[model samples]
Target chain A: MMMFTKPHPAQTIRSSDAVFEVKDLGVAYGRDAASVQVVNDVSLSVGRGEALGVVGESGCGKSQTMLAALGLLPRGGRITSGQVLLEGRNLVDLSPREMRAVRGSGIALISQDALTSLNPAMTIGTQMAEPMIHYGGMSRSAARTRCIELLDLVGIPGAATRLASYPHELSGGMRQRALIAMAISANPKVLIADEPTTALDVTTQSQILRLIDSLRKELGMALILITHDLGVVAGVADRVAVLYAGRVVETAETETLFASPRHPYTKALLDTISQLEDEVSERLNPIPGLPPDPRNPVQGCPFNPRCDYVRDVCRAELPALADSVEGGRHPVRCHVDPFVGLSLTMASGGAR
Target chain B: MSAPAIQLKDVSVRFPIRKGILRRVAGEVHAVDSVSFDIAEGETVGLVGESGSGKSTTGRALIGLAPLAGGTVECFGRDLRALRQAHGALPRMSQIVFQDPYASLNPRMTIGETLKEVLEVHELAKGHDADQRVGRLLDDVGLRRDLAERYPHALSGGQRQRVAIARALAIEPKFIVLDEVVSALDVSIQGQIVNLLQDLQQDRGLTYLFITHDLSIVRHVSHSIVVMYGGQIMEKGPRKSIFSAPLHPYTSALLSAVPVPNPRIERMRPRIDVRSEPPDPSAPLPGCRFQKSCLFATEICRTSRPQLRSMTGRDPDHLAACHHMQEPHVREALSRAAQGAVS
Candidate 1:
């Protein structure tokens, strides 16, 4: 919290310094009549050992953007325009054979549900070992040894015996740990955890958060944590980017973002969290309307319909993602300055 | 206390396990064991616990969905079984809104049809009267009158939930068991549903048994909270007492583990390490169900189950099931936590 926001906006971070960078990313799904532009002009960068948190509701393109980077998007989905750079190499232009090499070695993804992600028939060891042997080119016996070590690294107790257990046989917590171990086996430079704790209990969730944080620190890997729960990101993220509809609404250092949010959506979002001070009868000051449908192209600002601070300019013209103030590095996209209303809401003892 | 809106005395719900082939009774799983509480009229009581903790079972048992092995349930001063069997307006007094709106609602039926069906089943209204009643229910839940014409598939997740609430309301239920009604929706939408519920409660003087695993939302809507672990009650009290000065070790751990939205506060609070697996039902623990992972467990905790009791004279309304509250060391732990908060 003591760390101040950077004085300059995110000024075209070079791929040499950033472990992963997505530039002017755009993704769309479906054919002719059913086509939907799910992601539009989205851009972000993750420096080595940095943690970038992407916060958004469903259908906000949080997952699609990362999936585009990994070439894991479902059928009918295409990266219409973008550059996914890893170590200054463009991933979008890579052949399937080349992209396969980049996946396990350069970048890894931990999806939301571990049960569906794991192979039900395969033992945890076999599933884990296959990845290491195929990617790391280790022998079967050596890969087995590495599997146990990876399981132990993830904080799973009795790692050796647990290796033989199937996914269903293990608890949800243990299954998630195994999944994380598999993701990190090749020691990828960038780790993307998409709603990693959503399926677990609070106690299990806490343990997973701690484990992921310590692993990032120990291994010096860049991390991208995608979640709807702002609290999860607040604990571990170095920087935060809030997405709305299909655009970046706010981006800033974690401390600055929490202290002085400039976007109305961001401010309303901060208050949506239930705190100890909330009265039983008092309603949480939620953002007014649902997120815009992706099937239809939004005009001007996508959030104008739901934003409390909307004005004529907000509905007529799109806001540029520029510095909120003259010298501040915190970038916000909104035609109207949302601070006046945010301060009023804050004075009522919300967003503590 | 003008006879609580609903009362449960020594309530226990169990399920018998059967063996393979012969289908003989093996043993029983005490889903909800010796749980007892009262929900006063027009008050919201939150029931929170992890999966398999019997929180959901407790809610189901109240509505007769889960059979009570041994206990007595009284609703509006009438026996629950008798009231359910009488089948007049008695069945309309209690209704449940489930978690998954997509699955709970009929896909083929329009929102209007769903609400109208409930009204017809209860004989609350008919023909034009039913149509007008359905329209009013939609308005009460904050949905547009036009939305009633749409199918369940056409509505958004939040809108579908509102229709489900409207269906529950069409029967004119005085008591509702909201079993994770808002957990599946987005954060912004969750607030909308919660507000609608609060508004409906205000208008109808409805009593609710809100069950979920999310502690923050529970604190937001519940006047009082009940914490369950395994099959027994860990803590039960007014919201402030349970959130601020929880006496039970399980309650403290559960609350402490929830990630706070603020980075400074969340990062600062010391965590209660509870990575151990939840208790096994097949081999029930001899004493406290939470003893395996409890930080203050001693020999007595492993020998005898601690009953829910008020720890201090400051507030008798708050109750916790823990043996260490009598010890000076427990107060020391509380002081240390306070010191941690200051820094």
Candidate 2:
């Protein structure tokens, strides 16, 4: 069910060869005196038209990692090490102006908080057209026409008329659509949508998801959908990367990840989703205690304190990503074995 | 007959929208329009709808927070209007939990102070007894007894919400109004709170008016259900009956919109086409509130509002407000809509 843009023909693959290839990236705020590391040695890649999902609880450094990749981290924060390669270009070494060119033209980002991200006074049309004019070098008239087309593509009706409407005039759903349109206006090779449909209603969320799915397919852009909702990820993502305390504990094909979750943390997250109010009111299988505070970082496994099947080795050393039981394409970071804690026992034949 | 815990007989809530400083009555927004339902003792009835569906208004009216413009709200056989006129007790038997936990709880008050205030107002606990009761209530809602000294800002969203629940339970109310209680929480935390509420209801035999837009949660917690649209009850029945075989198009449409976690089911399901946002409550309509968007709506639907009526003998309590409920073609259309929803 998890599909990429390349799988679908007739789509313009923005960069059919390569989209993003990030390696050992790290972000740190302040210098040696008052320094704090937010994002560690993180490495990930997004294929052309592939949707990579980043999931974790709050303060897990999911946002900081992507911000570092985009070179959009806040005032105090800066990438301390590693390179972010987008379509063969290493953006880590780029200057401020060059990074700005790569941001909207090569890769675009849509933040979760639309209210603050959007210009309150500007009309939807003008905001949507800004990228086209600045990045695509389009004329005023051409950009306006493209903006309307982009809005229409995202399922907004009366796009021509609504062009004059301010951000406040549009509903929450409409504002999100306008944001997505602006993100894709430059035909960027990669689109990073951080919790795009988090606050929307179920129906509106579905619509926005479908719109994102269609845009990724049609534009052939690699999509990085950052969210905590497994249901959202289940519907759209091609691959999933589970982050914990600035480190990716697991990464795999969406189906393999959902089917036989290898890491204890991944298993807990999946178990939590099934416990959602689908039929009966079930007690929460809470991952007890808070995520490890970044201020005082842990020495061993980041998830050890909260992980249920922790072993002696788990407390002493960090588990590297290795082949899971199913032998999927990706490796899981765990030592105690996911199925032993899951009680699969081999005879149960894994989950349905 | 079992005494109904809470009953609304043709209940209506109308808020007047003003034009400006001139104070001209622009129009009366029909927040809850002639809605009627009954919740039996020890039963949970979910009132579900979209943002502007008046579900929250209905919940507010039950707890005496919002004024009822017309009809009657009978709580445990006593009419709320009659109680309002007498101006005594102030419905001590009912309490409400608002959507925003931060806004709902007093910022300045500590957890201990807030719960003590509730107990003091009801005169249910005093001195050492009051302190003991506060600790017990906090523990009941999954909060530590030692955390009572902390202010609201010191707590997380889930913890603050638990405090709100503890305060609602402080008065020992028989009925509680939960308005989108878990909507702001993380999914894992939501599951915990939901389970806690269910356990509380079972243990205390408390009646709950669970108002929310989450159909899945409603389907899980509700005993009986009422789907509201444009201030009217579009459908009402037992939870299983309504969710399994919804008669109204709006109910089916709303349920179909929730994304299933299973990839196979999601791929098999068809997308429901619910065009146009919810209508403005201030804009008065003569006929059906959903006529403009309902595909099966006819000319008669646009002329007169349909009264809530029974359409099947299977469940006398199951009712819907649609003229074509008995029509085979309409049934076919609904089935197709459901198919489209899953496809």
Candidate 3:
């Protein structure tokens, strides 16, 4: 509770300054023994004009964590524990009606698939204007004019004509831009974009990421970018939290995390990707096994099975997310400090 | 030198756009337009492009899945059309693995049954011999032999993809078309699959048409790269030349757009301003397909389509289609825009 109230003494930006925060949040599906804990003991905070990238693969609880925060978990899903705070208010305990009010006006989400997320039946103008009229108390004509402006802000050319067009009328990139425009219509303090560019081409993906970054700074909103691609996060996020099997394995500044990742899972994930500048190697160093099943619930460190440097202790007991250097902002959830007493190249599974 | 494994000459694939209950042809969507390429024996040709760029359609045309509107496809100097006309069936020498393994696989069939079905249809093996081959195919793809009994639903996405690859290999093909095979898998699993594919290609001496939108992966696997846009070939060259010194503006734009994993380089990189979506294929445009988004587009570019001509000062195989590629200013502008993109 004290961790929630006061800012960390070691950190520059405190939790008190955070526009949105999730403290030790846990989410589960089903009931009793059969229940599956998809997200466990997750703590994250984002301040005004700051972007936090939550990086993880499929079934790593990246989407579940955000869904729990928004009070938008599908049927049978429940927030098992912890608090999601928007400014001063606890969102986990909010009523259904109150949560509805907070959605577009307080925190908005832009999902991965724009086609499905959008209402195919409604015109793009109607969808964009509805939130403005309902939440901002604007007239129909005023809302219509504002929709065009919002569309133009997201780099949609001929915004006025696009408004009257249906969702099917626009291309994939255009539909995504419309979705982003609608999400920011209420000018929420926090924006959660879950895999916004996963379905897009590289060209369109860059454009969307740049737009989101600029908008976050312009509106001074806290941005949570949830994606599986490390490359996408590298450009946008100020800080990153690497997740594995529903737990935060490592957290650090974006540059530090990429330059000197501490955890074995984090290092392995970095090595797996084929970088644009990388000289073609004969083989890629892939993590040995698949991600652990959430339903089965592995003991100790969830990534032990797949970790190249896993020890006996790793399989027996769970490790705390603690900083290797005292008072440092970088925290890693691994018992073995691979970098200790080793050169950076030697520690990174050199020539293996 | 031995003949090329696969040769495509002015290949075009068109799907009719129909209207009304009678389904009259309103127009034609040219999915693949005059796409020509040659894959040398045991070489991997990476066909890269965004959606609706005809990369996938071209892959399908090679395997006889997509009917060709014009031109000839020859495998090992044998005309595919002539072979199919004489035998009443397309040769089984070529195979393809689709992107979504789950959709491509049957829900009711076990992995063993799926592999066995391909053998049975091809008349390659049967009975206990077929069962043994099924296990070997599963092993070849790095899947456990026990997994042959499990259904596709029971397997993970990576495992299902491996099974799909196993089925493709069941026919013992000389050529394979992998259409975004690793696009659906996780990054960690994608590496495993990519490595597996490389190993298989070396072992079997397989000629591969690796079609994907990911530039990084294509650079890793391909000997030569083919850049496509709006269902037309924009550039074709050795992978290193294409990466190091791209002659086409569209190719430079694509190379710039790929986000590097390194934060420092990513932040410093200058993105080429190819901001608009790809040209609509259904409504064919006159002149260069990329003219609308091209940074160096001129009046001539809007009036005449450029042909894929060899670059004078570069590798003989390095070819690009652009009216101003030979001009020093255009080359300097492209290099300036993409200077910070990669290194």
> Considering every candidate listed, which one attains the maximal TM-score?
3
Model 2 C-alpha lDDT per residue in residues A1-352, reported as the tens digit of each score: 4664436542234233557977788888899968888778787788988999888877778889889888888899998888898977899999999999888768899888777788998887787777677768899999888888888888888999999999988878888898888888878899999999877767678888888988999989999998877778878988899888888888888876776677777777766666554555445566665677787888789899988887888889987766656554666777776555356333225643
Query: Model 2, retained fraction of real contacts?
Result: 0.47
TM-score of 2: 0.90
Model 2 off-target regions past 4 Å? Answer: A1-18, A28-38, A131-139, A277-290, A296-299, A324-328, A338-351, B120-129, B327-343
lDDT of 2 by residue, B1-343 (tens): 6879899999999999889999999889999999999999988999998777899999999878889899999999998989988985476889999878999989999999999998988889898999999999998998999888999998888888999999999988999999999888766567678878988998999999999888767877888899998899999998877876678878877877786665666656754456777767888578888877676789999899987777766577788988777788877767765664333
Estimate every model's Cα lDDT from 0 to 1: 0.85, 0.82, 0.89
Better of 1 and 3 by TM-score: 3
lDDT winner between 2 and 3, please give it: 3
**What TM-score is obtained for chain B in each of the predicted models?**
0.94, 0.95, 0.97
DockQ of 2: 0.44
- Candidate 1 has a TM-score of 0.94
Estimate, for each residue in B1-343, the C-alpha lDDT of model 3 and write its tens digit: 5778899999999999999999999999989899899999999999999998999999999988999999889998899889889999877799999999989999999999999999998899999999999989988999899998899999999999999999999888899999999988888888889889989988989999999988989989998999999999999988988998889999998888888888988888776878577888888788899999988889998889999998786799999999999999988878876676656
Scored by lDDT, model 3 comes in at 0.89
Model 1 misplaced regions, further than 4 Å = A1-15, A31-34, A274-276, A324-328, A338-352, B84-90, B334-343
